[model samples]
Target chain A: MNDKVAQTVKTKGITRRFLIIFSVAFCLLLASASTHYFIVERSERIERETRELLNIRLGKAAIERDMQDVISDLTFLARHNETSGIFLPDNLDARQALAQQFRVFSEQKGRYHQIRVLDETGQEIVRVNYNNGEPIATSETLLQNKSDRYYFTETWATEGRNTYISPFDLNIEHGEIEIPEVPMVRFGTLMFDENGNKRGVLLLNYLGSTVIEDFREATANIADHAMLLNSDGYWLSNVEKDREWGFMFGRNDTLAEHFPDAWQRINARDTGQFSNRDGLFSFTTVYPISSSQGNLGDGLGSLPADTSYYWKAVSHLPPQSFSASLGEFLRRNMPLYSTMFIFLAASSFIVALTRFHHRQAVSEVETERSFRELLERRVDERTDELKTAQVEKDLVVQHLIQAEKMTAIGTMASGIGHEINNPLYAILGLAEAIRDDDSREQARGHAGKILSYTKDIAAIVRNLTGYARPFSGTEHKPIDINEVIHKAVSMVKRSLYDDRIEFRTDLGGLPGFSAHSEEIHQVFFNIIRNGVQSIEDDGSLMITSRYDGEKIVINVKDDGKGIAPEDHSKVFDPFFTTKDPDQGEGMGLYVVHQIIQKYKGSISLESVVGKGTTCVIEFPILPSVKKGNP
Target chain B: MMKQKILVVDDEESVRETIRLQLKSTGHEIIEAEDGKQAILLLGQSNSHGVSVIICDVRMPNINGIEAVSFFRRDHPSIPVIVLTGYPDIKLAAEFVEKGIFDYVVKPVEKERLIAKVEKAAIQSAVMNIVD
Candidate 1:
């Protein structure tokens, strides 16, 4: 007896151990799923941010290309003697001619700041500025004396083959004396004579703020920071210049320190890109400056691409910047972690509850063992209780289905009503006018007839309203099936007809029958319309109806495109339209199925992809009730 | 006898045809234009002379029916204009009425109702002609 008790105790302990282990495993699984969800969400956000940064970088690169193109055009035009003649010693004829040319160039480009010509020796010859009549300055000093300047040295050394773009400066002046102060970013290109002799340099200065302004205007909504930097780590343009570039430049640190191997590669190869430790990615492209003048060289002597234009290097910053505020980063990620933590807590609670329940069951089993017959009787009672529970569950399911149907019907009714009301207003207005007109006898007679017809219109409206909300188990009535079909087709077609999809009706030989006409009409309309949409290209839909002894058979078939076999069964499921979620609620076929079932009809579908789909509906015909002569 | 000219304005050719067919039995001359822009050009050219009434469908692509009616009232006050609309909102109806629209008709238009409205508009126009 002592050994039997020991065995029972050991069995109970083993059961308890199993319950605890199972509960812990289940809780761990739940926690793992929650963690995975958090990780996936975080990764998606990071990816989106990375893409945005890439787009911004590409946009900036395009803008820079355009600026270079403009500069090149100015350089080419300036090489002509007729173009440079304006810069010659204050000759009225030449100055006026140059001013006219400048006006045309400015009008065409919409943003050229000034055009200036410099002698081969680097002395300013003549200039036209866009500062609303600012005074023009000439270099009295010898051009040879200032050969060290980038504009002069590059032009002279490259033998008029290079163009120079100057950095942003505040006090640059251009054109006539009366104009306002022009804060300019200047560019200069050399001009060579036909004999290859260095002639002069053509300089164009544009508003620096305007260049940055255009970029900012184009990307006003982008949230990421954008900055322009030189190979020497000089800040070119930044929205918050002092905060971002100021801090970096003040430290005199190589970009390699901040960007790591990526910056090192960019400097080594003149172009490189990499993602930061935090997964912030960056792309950098560098174009070599052929001369100290910041001039891009032309395709002379194996210079990378055409350097005759200013070489530009572009780079996109990574999505996760080390410079991001710790507070903001934490805030953005808190939701994911919080969700995971909540899931963990819930799972733990469930584990605890399950452990308690298992202990209770063990204790109950021990107590029940003392009354074996009583326990068997209790089990029988429990089985009966389970049957009652199942019945209740079925009732709940029925109620849920009804509620869902009502909700769907309500939504569809609102959409249809809104669509129908527009036409109804026109009918109402025309009818009212007829009633008010007391003109010629013939006209008045016509008006009288129209008034009666409008009453028929009101009746149609009433029918539509009733049809939109048919009660469950409503008795089927004798209805003209052909008219219902025509009405439904016309209703849907009138609203959606466009250049893309032409509605073609092959509706032939539809017989009049007795059934719930409105319901059947909705079913036919929904199915036919769906078929029409399935054929995206210009296609034809053939709808045919025939009487098959005791039943009416209707077939809707499309010829443009067909549904995949896998999706065929899913088409009739609720919220399962192949159309975009925004365009369709996917409930059309589901509603049609419900209506057909309600009217004791059966619907079947057959489809072949790239060929077409056909839907056949069969409905029982009801006997018509004749109205007594009234 | 001169054919009674009827001006029809709708964005849709099919909708215009639906009305045209219903009015064909009346033996009136039917003139159709797609939108207010085309209707204005036709009216300006006097291509639809002796036009008994103008029937315009609202919610057209460019200028709507109510706006077209207002334009007609301003340019040709003697011409009675009817506004046809699918939307029967009270606010829109009130706005059309204020613009001196001869009538407003709704869509899925009852064929007979539309005919009667057109006939009444024609008679009113005739009475105005007699008064003038």
Candidate 2:
């Protein structure tokens, strides 16, 4: 009982060990794998951010170089002696020389599209137009603007002589795109004599196409979405051409307008990059904005405050830029991945094995239970079979007893009939003889013979009726052994006589026994009748009774054809017979043996083939106890 | 019919004597034997009287009526046998009669019926056209 329990606990211990090992291995693999993923992700992110920031600064520097070139060209024009000679009291020769000098300056330096000199009244003092490939100074008649132009008014409003750079846009002539769509910006600065005079503004129109074109060329080789937006988040240049310069065209579709959430983070941080599921966006305020470009002060120095009015450059890298392949990471850490996989697989296999064994154990238990039930059912069936067999055996025994009684009666019936029949015949024949006899002597003699034959029939009838009647005597009585033998012989003598056999009874001095006399008589009768039937003809039966020591011995012997050796063993068995079915029921010796046994007597036979048979019964002088009628 | 000769066979002496006495009043001759074997032997003798009819009992120690009749059938084909029995075993009696026995009579027999049966058997024997 406890053995199975202990085995189950042992099995549980082995499985639990595997379970704990699998759980710890699985958790450790998961933690390490995730940690490696985060580290790789963060490193890739920082590398990509630094590359984007460098590209943004590159784009801003291009724009600033174009602005510095315009300012240097304007300052060189202002310091020329031909331009200051105008303040030396109008010498015609000096004025003509200045015109010639301006023409030559435009021919030599062709980056400027237009150059002019204006006084405080916004008059063009001297102008030169670079037409085609050469510059030509305009006559005095073509210097038309007095003061309405913004570059002229914005410069004259400055308290000190200071330089101003105009916003970059597509050049428009009379509210229409200029021929060939020239992108331009105007540079204006106040001009004054050596000490303190407030002179007019000198301005130049610079070509802005080179800077925007350079930004586009730099971004063309890379897959990153690069855009350049100004201080107000207006797109200056975008990889998508439609998004650029929207604020300049009054559309104002800026980066802040499209992605407000990203703009909030971008507005708070400078020179930073972040990643989201959609894409990678890196931005930098390369030239930081200080105050609004609409306001200006007296200071004209190139201070930090002056440089603050500048544009921002932004680059959009797509989602692929931020995440490196986890596959590549796994390839580098092949042993680690393989270990985790093997652990998981082994755990799964163990779990499956445990489940299979659990099912097997359950099925085995069920099989045992079913087998026990079957055994119980078989035991019940066997018990029932035994009971039924016992009942059948009881019925067989009952039938055997009834058959034995009928057999005894049948064996005696024919002999009894012959006994009665012979006498009847003698009586009928003698009665006729008597009636016909006239002499008294002869008639009297026939009548006497008839009376004796009648007596013979009466004796036979008495014996038959006595035997047929249900016996009421069961008590043991003191019986003369010789008397019982004589009575037994009387019943069977007629049949013996009919067969031409002689039955002689010799009665010796025999003591009486306490027994059922009729039963003992039956035993004698059975042997004598059997003796008579065994003879074919001229046989003799002899019955003798005597006392020997403590036993009373009765012998009935037949001088007839003897029982065969093969049949001797079965002669006393019930239903064993050599006689015809009509003649006997064949239970004679078996019943005789049983009756002798009831008195505690034993009967034995001795015989020789073709000689004779002898049946000897020896019973005690007294029975141990009286038996009821069977 | 030449005054028919009758043979009576019985195992018992009293029955034979009674049958002899019974046939004495008749003018016909009577012959007797103790059993069927003696009756058959008497018929087989050269000096034996001509037995036209035989009355024999079935229950006898040696050569009972059935054997005597069945044996005499081939030897004395002209003679007819009548079966008489003390026990009324009609099936056996009838079986013998079917094999050309003259008649069957049960014992404790009526004398009148016995005499009539004997006369009929005598006449039957005389008239039988058996080749012998």
Candidate 3:
């Protein structure tokens, strides 16, 4: 199983593929995560803006409801003439009672700037201020312009109902004191008899700053500007109020400029939401407050039957701002993520390298084993081949040795034949010469006497040639020593007769020996012949045969020049003849020695330089043989 | 004087006949012994008849010619002896020559040479008789 795993690892490029897959997957995951974070940040900004818009619109609606309630209360007091006839009553008690009621009504409305009652002729009959000061004569100026004032006109136009005024300023004076002008949001109403006859008018004013305060409180968590604007493209309230409405209107304008477009769309119809050029997202919800009450002023006549009380709740969250924070967070954590990735990649690389190394090691071991097996087989084959060749070489060498021996024997045979031929020729010539002699009548008898000697000579020659010839067969016989000696001397005599060398034979009776007779004859002839040729002048060759208990000994002693001392031992060595090459083939003594050894005999030589040389040979007699045996 | 008689002993008859013919032609009476035994017997007979010299081959059958000469010296030392031979046997012949024999010759005998040696032997025999 482990081996299989190793094979799989080797074939699959597993580590490389794994690293490639891991890196690609990790990069994809990182990219997707980054995209998701970006989308979420953008969506969070959008959602936060939307939530701020809804909150600001809810706050503006609450303020519009409060204004409607104040208008209705003032219209009820004017129609009853309880609060409107405060300044028209002649009695001090009645005037005091109406003024007290107006002051109580103004105090009950929290956003009101002032409350006042005017006569049918547009004189300011009574006034109530939130600061609680006595009315001055200049407060009557508001009544003089009652036809232009939203409070008087709205009350006269709307027969007996409350009316909301457009946002404006109010002039109020107390006795000998002028009250500061207050920008107001006002409402008015007129009193009427039961028969619908016109009565005195009622007016109520609210502080415009109060609307911006409510919007700011509602959208505080939204992270953008907030404002409210009316239908005439005027800001009812802006959180940043110091800037002109124009500065908030264009692409390069302030946060308040986005309010008018938002408000106009709201006032033209129902609620609407938009993103403006000043980087504000605004939602305007319109609550249509009833302006039928005369408490709302003259501008109420321009209001739709359902008056658009526009509350623009605008909030902006910038894309650039959220992305900056997200980028900072990523930068802070980048080193940690990168370090983790590097560690994982390095471990993967090390594992791949180790697996590669293991595969190489295994392959090397397998290759080495195969190589060793091949080497062993080759060595075995070579050794077998060498042994076969060695055996063949030995066979060739044996044949070569046999061939050399045959060549040597052939040379010796030719030499021996030549040596013996000379002697036989001499003997034949001598015998013929004796036979041809005719000088004396007795010479014929002498010729007849030599016939037997010539026959002996011929017999000796035949025996020599037969011995000198290579063996044709194997045979052994008892041969007389006397006869072999006589033949040897006769042969030597025939050859050396011209040298005047004399040969003497002493044949002591001896038991005959069993041997190859022709071979022994050749041995004797070769030795005696060599002795006869050694002499330079007249000399004697003495040959003797005797018996030594179990052996027959033949000695050939020569008075010729003796052998050299140095040459004595080597004389029997093959090719070591002392004679001249033309007369001797150096094989005579060597063959003699070999034949003697074959007969279980021995030959020895004793010599003196001027005296002689003697060669003695002894052959063991066979106990079972007689002299005449074949 | 009767022709000077010469005795020739040789075991070889051819050698003996050759020497006899050669000496006979030279006006010497030739006597012969076929072997050493015959020559010894003949030498004893011829000594009484006044034989002047004896010529003999040294090698013979039964008794050698040199031994016959020794016998002759003992029995009749004054007779002159001449040795003849078919082959050279100088050492054996030199013995007889030293013993005051007539002379020695090797055969095939030269006729003039034999006659000369015979004349010298005859003179020596006469001087020896006078000395006796």
Q: Please give, for every candidate in the order listed, the TM-score of chain B alone compared with the true chain B.
A: 0.92, 0.87, 0.84
Ranking by DockQ: 2, 1, 3
Residue range A122-162, candidate 1, lDDT tens digits: 66655555544443333234222444567566555553455
Give the per-residue Cα lDDT of candidate 2 at A564. 91
Considering TM-score, where higher is better, how would the candidates rank from best to worst? 2, 3, 1
Candidate 2 lDDT over residue span B9-126, tens digit each? 8877777776776676666788788876787789878645578888887767667667777877767777778777655565676778677887777666767788888888777777
DockQ of each: 0.06, 0.25, 0.03
For candidate 2, lDDT tens digit of each residue in A85-179?
66454665665576677777777766667788776677787778878557888887777775987878877775554466676667787878686
Superposed by TM-score, candidate 1 places the C-alpha of residue A558 at a distance from the truth, in angstroms, of: 99
lDDT by residue for model 3 over B4-54, one digit each (tens)?
777767655545555655555557777777777887777657353677677
Docking class of 1: incorrect
Cα RMSD for predicted model 1: 54.2
lDDT pick, better of 1 and 2? 2
TM-score of chain A of 3: 0.48
Which candidate model has the greater DockQ, 1 or 3?
1
Return the clash pairs for model 2, or none: A119-A200, A122-A146
lDDT of 2 at A424: 77
List model 3 lDDT by residue over A1-630, tens digit each: 999997886657656655675677568657765786677666866775667667766666655555556555655666566433354446556655666776666666556666676666666666766774433222433434355555676667764353546543233445221334344566666655456656566676666545446555655655245555445445445545444243223323433355455445545554555544434355565442542322355443433354444433444444464557577656765686577567656655666666667667787788898888999899899889888986685454334323333433343443333233323333433344454455665555545645654564477557555544544445666677678778666655544324357778888877757666666667777787788788776677888888766777788999988988998889988678666665566767777776777678899999988888999998876666645322
> How many clashing residue pairs, candidate 3?
27
Candidate 3 chain A has its poorest 10 consecutive residues by lDDT at A414-423
